[model samples]
Target: MFRISPFIFILIFLTACTLPFNQPILTEGATVPRPQNAATAPVEEQTEPPTAIPDTQTQPTDIQNDTTNGATTDNLEELANTTPADRDQVALVEALTGNDLPEFARTEPLDVQVGDTETFWVSDILNDSNYEVDARLRYAGPHVLMYFETAVDDQIRQEDIDRAAQEFEERIYPRNRALFGEELSPGVDGDTRLTILNITLQGAGGYFSSADSVVQEVNRFSNEREMFVVGLNSFPVGESSYGSVLAHEFQHMIHWHEQRRGPAWFNEGLSTLAEDLNDFGDDNTTILHIQNPDIQLTTWSNNAAQTGQHYGTSQLFMRYVYEQYAQDGGLAQLIQDDAGNNLAAFATMAQQTRPDINSFADIVADWAVANLVNNPSIDDGRYAYSLLPETTTPVDLELNTINDINQFGADYLTLPTGTTTLTFDGSDTVSLTGATPNSGQYAWWSNRGDDSVSTLTRSFDLRDLTQATLQFSLWHEIEYNWDYGYVAVSTDSGETWTTLEGQTTTKEDPQGNNAGTYGLTGISGKPGIETDQGEVGQWIEEQMDLTPFVGQEIQVRFWLIQDDAYNANGMLIDDVRIPELDYVDDFEEADESWEGQGFVRTTGTLPQQWTLRLVKEVGSETIVESVETNEAGQANISVNDGETGVLVVVASTPYTTQTATYTIQSETR
Candidate 1:
């Protein structure tokens, strides 16, 4: 397992495709077998994070962006430099300005047609305010208002506008509207026609601003127009992917109106799907993802290196979900569901469409299987890609110590060639050692994703114990007062629950004033965890007394809860044991150290081999004999004539999922 850079800053802002989405306010939870104590040392942000595996095979060049397709490529170089901070600040300010709605710049609609010219406030590539433009409406359909930046209108060909308008009115608008639901129509911009301001966007092909849908009498902040800011340079009319960009940006508009709470990954996924649905084109980012599948699916950042993977993988997952489970309008259901984000949104969509699918994990499990083994011919394409061509080249390596492979990501490893037998033992040879506490990362679950819940649980019969003390090595980098990580117990089969406090449990006052503790169980930590510097504090040996329920059978769970706003690696637990019950779990052995989502140390070869080869395991044929492993994580892998043994280690959670594997790989002799 290769160690990607430890620094992954999540952008938790509102922006369209190509712009960094909501960044991690503070996170990931890994099932560390045992993390020795380390302190959170102050550090500066890295220039960029990770070991980006390069593509060995030649990637098919994108034909959509060539000069031949009418796309202006000179300014495409300017795309990556445009930061989302301006849009993020605008959103933050708007949120803070809650209920302070101002009068609309215009109470009525723009009574204009295709040739009408209008002066509109537009942001430059940098989202600077003073870049207003007078734009002529080129395409005024019943549903769309395609405006050309008058400055560049003469340069753009009339044929390109006709081609783009035809797609928008006939293909993009109706198709997306039917699939993703409607954008805010007759909006505060006083227009029924959704505006598509085709300016030369800073670096993005286009972006949707909530500010455009907003209004104020004097404040120049809001565009006070229902519009999407598109770049003339990125998607010159008549370009192949232009309709896709339109479809993509249109989705952000509708999504803003509908499921505003949806996570960036989910929203971006749907937006890309909008492109696919409109018949514009498939997502071009797949090559980036196949080259580096270890990019965390749910976690997002502004880095140019990983941004393509983020979009590519997002489309890959969402498209899989849509293809496999979304039978009766599931995509629409997902966009309409306001309560769900990430896997939660899919869970809701699945429940409504396909009731048999209990959790998103089931889908993820199938999808993971599909990623490694994509055979559309098998099981009705359940374990295959109906849309994407599988282009994974699993990183081949000897068994090395893999520490923090980000969640909802997978690391495919090819065993060294010329090996006859392979063995894996989960004890010392194989274990998920969570990120080094207080050091490179916060805890075992290092850099947890926003709105994620990672849990480690076990059921225990405590009737024999007179007194029991729960003990564990715990470290957390939770957002103070806003997000939480704690130990909770449930006696009624998880129907009801009670939180057990520990040494670090403190009432966090989100406000500066010492407000009532209320239901908020502040930051769970020792005195020094909250340092002036943002690095996580040291790991603490914690205990929560369970003596009160000594006579009953109980279920105990270690939990981490994060909100959508900020970033914080929720919590990490290691060496958990109860004194009276004489039960202990070091997470070293391939057994039930604890039974839950965060970490599973497996026995034999089920977990390891599942992620390894044997792409499809259905009906009578075992792709290859299962490699046998002992109490120690040792696997006996049989290498064929020229084929390499590819081992994949993956874990999925409710909202946030990630890939983590052992440092221990089969040493080919």
Candidate 2:
């Protein structure tokens, strides 16, 4: 294992731990770097556009002609003599104009001719704290990530970082579709490029990703850009409810569509509205249930309430006013009504929405009162109280050699006896990429002798077997001659065998029916078994029900008797196993006594509650003891279940808690 920083290693280890069982199981593009790591949910909504083009008045352009024959030489001389300090100022101007800057001191030189690219006076290097960068959109070529750094430390909060991302997605590039309604290209230079790094909360100000995992943040004046920042300090770590913080910032980008900029109320209120309210007639409002401080809904923040509530309630207040007063155009209309103005007129317009502006204040007061008994539970669809019984350690059975059975691989299994090694390879087709070789052999074979028996005994347990499965492998070349294989079971070691299964395959004529004579079959052929090249690397998976064979200790054996030498060439085996229930049966195995009966059973409600039916065969019966389950979804108990005449349990509410009893049932016939 490579050494990683504490943060990186922790994340990596968690990733591996949580991969085996993922909540809301992910599909496609999901990577599990380690266990115990929660999988990230896919972005359900775009939330915001990629980037917002600055809305500014256009300026007329003027150009001077280079009339002199020596003008080109003059320009080169002037450019070469420019000082580094002069170039910095020029670069700053270029940034504002969204134009490329020329090569200057403190920067690498550009080889292209001056005519191909524009120039700007470079300014001070932008640092991390003072500014932020929206590096999510720019993923291609050199200098794709814009830098925004300040001298101030601890300026970049996690929430601010997340908000910046959401705003860019919802405001700028709405989706992968081009402005002209064309599909975006796959690469970064293309329109629909995606940023590898999602969000960072490190010491750096600007964000840049050289690859999917690495990021670099720097604080320099020259790095300053119009980057968005979010503040995550308002919420607790691991608490997902504060997702509205993202929605709030996203509205900033959306509001920019109507008004280029505005006061904190208009921007903040509208952004807040994205959390609890929406006027677009779309259900884009964030869906979150807040607990505590439940007052009549009003625009007020509670210290005790979670972070999401503060921002969400703020947005809800703004939305309530907009919906009540403005019907025709609403907020959108109000923004368009302003000729590049601020929220000063908002108070007046808000009067139309709420005649009693003070009503919201009362609502907030009511919320404070309601906070006393406001403890509500929440379900976010991704978690549950008790999922499944946790397995502390893996099953103790020796996977390398089950019951002395040895030699198994993805494609082939071999059992060595005498001079020849019997091989059964499952030419199973591959479903997952890079999992196992699809063309190789897969099999499990054992030739271990039981110390107490003379004949070779092969105990087999197969769970899923089905009809139409004639034990065929795709790698076997010969046509269907599969009738030669036979399956048998023996009770007393392998002394006597009872034929249980057999399969046969035939080569039918292309037209369907068998040829007129025996060997004259041009299309139809008799069922025969073959082990040619074709059937060596294929596997057949089937579902079999083995309810009839219980109690009787059985040993299974498969013999591929060859009718023709060609039938002895290839064979593949797969999904080959006799499955046993969670509880092992008592038969020849010693110490099959009642091991202090495990008093755990399943129970449900009246109509669906499980009834425990105990049947006595011989000997005596004893009711040992009973225990109650303390865990959630555990059960309580009742002594009887009507006609079943055994132990019964009344199902509990919330479908929780169960109880079980240990009882020994026997009879003297």
The candidate maximizing lDDT is 1
Q: lDDT by residue for model 2 over 154-187, one digit each (tens)?
A: 3445454445445435543342111112111222
Residue 531 in candidate 2, Cα distance off native in Å: 86
Q: Evaluated with TM-score, which candidate comes out highest?
A: 1
- Predictions in order: lDDT: 0.51, 0.24
TM-score of 1: 0.56
Give the CA lDDT, 0 to 100, for residue 414 in model 1: 61
- Give me the overall lDDT of model 1: 0.51
**Count of backbone clashes, every candidate in sequence:** 52, 117
Q: Put down candidate 1 lDDT per residue, 506-600, tens digits, no spaces.
A: 44322211111111122233332321133333455667778777889998876554433233434555567676677766554435435555322
Q: Give the TM-score of candidate 2.
A: 0.22
Off by over 4 Å in 2: 1-197, 202-247, 254-266, 275-309, 333-347, 350-669
